[model samples]
Target: MRITKVKYKDALIQALLFIYLIFTVYPVFLMVITALKTNAEIIKHPLSMPIKLNFSGFIKIFTTQNFALYFRNSFFVTVLSILITVFVSILLSYALARYKMKYVNPLSIYFLAGMMIPIRLGVLYINELLNTLNLIDSLIGLILVYTAMTIPFSMFIFMGFIKMVPVELDESAYIDGCSERKILFRIIAPLIKPAVATVTIYNFVPIWNDVYFPLIFIHSPEKKTLLLAVTIFFGQFQTDWSLVFSALTVATIPVLTIYLVGSKYFIRGLTSGALKG
Candidate 1:
């Protein structure tokens, strides 16, 4: 009787999860299908399947709308910023994890404090500082902003994983005549693959999707990120749903690709960090 009840409960949970998955995925399915329809078809049969796949909207966006430039800008900023954030966070986290120092705990608290306060609260000051440094309206400025914004969270993740690594590995490497850099890069980093992947995947999506920072810092039409360029599809009188869907579909590709690539490690990292931390 108890076994039957447990089986029934498991089945109910699975059914609910399947329903939830449909709710989450149906909109994305609709958007992809809608992007394949012409404007006339979309107007006539908003929810109907496309009679024929259309590539014109995608073509026009790249050919006429400077979308390629926006894509390039977003890719450059997101990738570079993530690279810098991960590199710096790894070094800092490794030190904090392994070293015994008087101020280490206080220093960790100081860095973690950034996560408690929303970075947007200091936009005025950030803007003023960027202006003072002559980095406004520049991709470099955006990269720096994104790097700073992501580092705290990245370090948090890295430190969790770094702490889980046994200290004996460092001692073994040192006895084998390995330098600190060699021990860190060769010994420690390999053990933290999941954490590295988790940090990269976590930061990648937000940085790619962010419009708030780009809108405030970038005024040049040519320098706008992909999400910023998407505003062109909106207007007061009538919205071009076809163009909007096409642009959205294009924007979704990179994020999906990154997630899929990192998903294996990402799941493991989350589980490991949760269980071990």
Candidate 2:
């Protein structure tokens, strides 16, 4: 009776889980289905399987649009932004975690403030500042904004993770005559690596998906990023739903790939499991 009850409960839970998964995933599944079908088939059979596969929407998108440029630009900005955010955040977090100082907490609170404040609220000022630096509508302009926007949260995550690590590791390194930098890289950083993966996955996806900053800061045809590429698909086809679906499905590949690769570390970091024995 006990085993039978357990089996029944497990079956019910699995059924619910499958329903939720389908509910979440079906829209994208439908969109991909649409992208692969002709407009006639989509209109006639909405959810039915495609009669024949179509790559025309995708072909038109690449050939008629500056999609390649957008992919390159977004790739460059996101990659550079992630590298900078991680480097600055980890070292700064180490200092706050390992060294006691009068202002460390206050400085951390400052980052918290920045995190809470929306970057778009400062749009006017940021645009003006970038103008003075001649960086407006440039990839550099996008990178600057992305870095500033993500720093606070990244710092916060790193701080919590570094705290979770034992200070004994730092002390042991110091006893061996290792310098501060050496202690950070060789001992502390290696210990707290999981949290870094967590922060990266969280920040990287948003940075890649952001439409507002790129819309505001990147204007030149040569410099438009991927989200902006999705916009072009909207215009040239006069809102062709088929092409829009194709472009969107294609654009989602990178973000999904990144999440799949980083998700394991992200889970570890969120659970703070890396700090355990």
List, residue by residue over 34-91, the lDDT tens digit for candidate 2.
8888877877898997788998888877888667778888899999998999999898
Q: Look at candidate 1 and tell me the lDDT of residue 97.
A: 94
**Number of clashing pairs per prediction, in order:** 0, 0
Candidate 2, overall lDDT?
A: 0.83
**In terms of TM-score, how similar is model 1 to the real structure?**
0.89
72 in model 1: Cα distance from truth in Å?
1.0
Candidate 1: deviation at residue 177, Å? 2.7
Instruction: State the RMSD for candidate 1.
Output: 2.8
Q: Write the per-residue lDDT of candidate 1 for residues 80-184, one digit (tens) a residue.
A: 999999999999999999999998999898988876677988899999999999999999999999999988888888998899999998998899999999999
**Global lDDT scores for all candidate models:** 0.87, 0.83
Error of 2 at 150 (Å): 1.1
Candidate 1 backbone collisions, by pair = none
What are the RMSD figures for all models against the true structure? 2.8, 3.3
Off by over 4 Å in 2: 1-6, 266-277
Error of 2 at 158 (Å): 1.3
Local lDDT at 152 for model 2 = 81
